[model samples]
Each structure stands twice: as C-alpha cells, then as structure tokens.
Target: MPRRQHITVFAILALFAFIGTSFVLMFRSQPQGADYPGPTSQEPVLVDNEILLGTATAPKLENETLKAELGNAAWKVLHTTMAKFPDKPTEEDSQALKSYIHLFARLYPCGECARHFQQILAKFPPQVATRSTAAAWACHVHNEVNKSLKKDLFDCSKIGDFYDCGCADDGPVKGKEKEKEKDGFKQLELEKEG
Candidate 1:
C-alpha cells in the first residue's frame, strides 16, 4: 500500500511539472505589440530638429477636389470634419482629432482615420508640428481611444492589426516630406507606448 501511495504522489508531481512547462513555452512564443518594424537597436531614432517647430499647421483639406480624391476610408472622416469646420477652427476640432487618436490606439479601434491624420501631420513644419496644441490634443485622443477599446475585447491580435503602422501605405521619401513622415511615425510609436 505504501509503495502504491508513493507512485501516486510521483505521478501527480509529474503532471504538474508538465502543465507548468507547457504554459511557459506558450507564453514565450507569443509576439509582443503591433508587428510594425521597429528600430532594431535600443538607441532612439533622432527627431528632426527642423520638424520640432512650435505648432503644427492645420492641413489643407477644404477643396472639393481634394476631398473627392482621398482614397482611404479613414481620410474621409478627416475630410468630413474639415468640411464641417470650414474656415473657423475651434477647440472642438482639436478635441475631435484627439478623440480620433485615442480611438485609433485601441486594439480593435478603427485606426484608418487616425493613421491618415498622422501622415498628414508629418508634412507640417517643425514649429507647427511640435507647437500645435491641436496635434497634442489628438495624441491624447489616440491614447484614450486605445484604453477605451481594450476594455471588453478578448482578442488583442485583431486590435493590434487595426492599429499597426505596417498596415499603413505611407512611406518616407528622400526629402523634407520624408523628415515629416519620420517625425510622425515616431510620434505615433510614442503614443502607442504610452
């Protein structure tokens, strides 16, 4: 009887060990965050000094032709907002941008529109890029949106894809616009981290 008891105890211990090992292996194999290609090294990418200017300028999206030409569904949201705001810029416009950003940051949140805005901001002058209170507000929005969207969601993978930068088509070119794109990408990455 004693030998039988010892064997039973050993079997239980082995079972527990097998379960724990399996759990550890599964956790380690999972991918972290969005699949966007991040900087390989620990060193931070240098921000464009020229793009660090005061306030980001409001992008021109008013012309009917430009509005009609926008290809992305997300750009349409921005265009609709521009159409509603027209000539007079308000605190609401800034708030709207912020709200969109926050929503885009969420795992399953709609990111198409917010990504488009980031691309547009990448074209602004440094002073305008850094100083725009509106842009700062939008960043806050992006953060908030992410938080709100993750509350009830189970699958984080879907959300990551929705917000991932690799999904965006905007690429950096070899000129001033490229500099702006870099800054914009950095800003989005920072926002995601926060």
Candidate 2:
C-alpha cells in the first residue's frame, strides 16, 4: 500500500469513529420533546452544532425548489451507495451501511424529510445483507417515499443499471474500497464500533 493512500484511509476511519461516538452520546442525551407521528411535509430539525443533543424545530424552507433539489440530491447519493455496496457484506460492513442510513435520517437538512425517512426506516429497516437486496431495498423505500409525496414511482428492476458507479467499467480500481464517496461519507455518524 502507498504511504499517502494509507494515511487517507486512516483519516477517514478516524473521522467516522469520532462521529459515531458523538452520535451515541447525543442519542443518550436528547431532551424530552413532543411526539410527532406520521408523514409531514415539514419536520423538526436539529439546529446546527446543537445536533449533538439538539432541539427539533421546523426549519423554514425559502422555496419549494430548494427542498426538491436537496431531497433529490440526497436520494441520488443514497441510491448510489446502495448500488456500490458489497455483494455479500460482512457484519461490520452491513452495520456501517445501516448506521449510515439512520444517521442520514438525523442529519438530513430538511427536518420533515428526515422525519419521513425515520418513519420509513422504522417500517422497513435497511437491508444490507447483499448488494442486490440492498439496492432493491433502497428502491422500495424510495418508492414508498414517492408514494407519500404523490410523485412518480421508479421501477426497481432497472435500478442497478440506473446508478452504476462506473467503478466496474474499467475493471476494479485498486484501493477503491478504502476511498470514501461523497454520498453520505460527509455525514457518517452512528458507526458500528468493533
């Protein structure tokens, strides 16, 4: 392994470790709040910097386009992550993906969207047992979300071809496994500790 590559991998791992720990502590310390059940167009948000045991309030969206764009971008990254998940993930790998899915629900900038995802997750936990299952799972949940919003549904059968990472196009890229994609890597909290 090259020295620079090793260092980068080490750094990303460390970052995830730190974020995961913070999330655990935060979860333990969340203050009591009103219970909100079911889907809502607007949801409570964790204030910036206060996410480590923060309050949930409805964040005002300046416009409709912003919300749509954010949700679209987040879904793209999430679907792509599922597409690239290992064919047969180990316990740790599966846990990482699972944790990321939940963490994403918390960190999603749109409070209501986050709440909706959390509700969706409760109904359909992340299926990270294998690549095909995980991808299909993502598509199903996304369709559920679409149904809730009265949006067009996507066909799961074509998801694999729709979100190819292109990593396989030129054969396997060595060291690619350690390299973090932008998707949810930036928000990798709730990690599974070994």
* lDDT for each candidate structure: 0.41, 0.73
- The sequence of per-residue lDDT tens digits that candidate 1 reaches over residues 76-162 is 353233223312345554444444433332211223433443444344211112212233333344344335446333232222223
Candidate 1: stretches off by over 4 Å: 34-194
Best by lDDT: 2
Error of 1 at 111 (Å): 25
Per-residue CA lDDT of candidate 2, range 1-194, in tens? Answer: 99999999999999999999999999877666846554565865443433422332446456779999988898899999987888678988997787777777767788777777778887887787777677778888899999998999987766755787566765764465424443323232222222
Clashes of each: 21, 1
How much is the lDDT of residue 2 in candidate 2?
Answer: 100
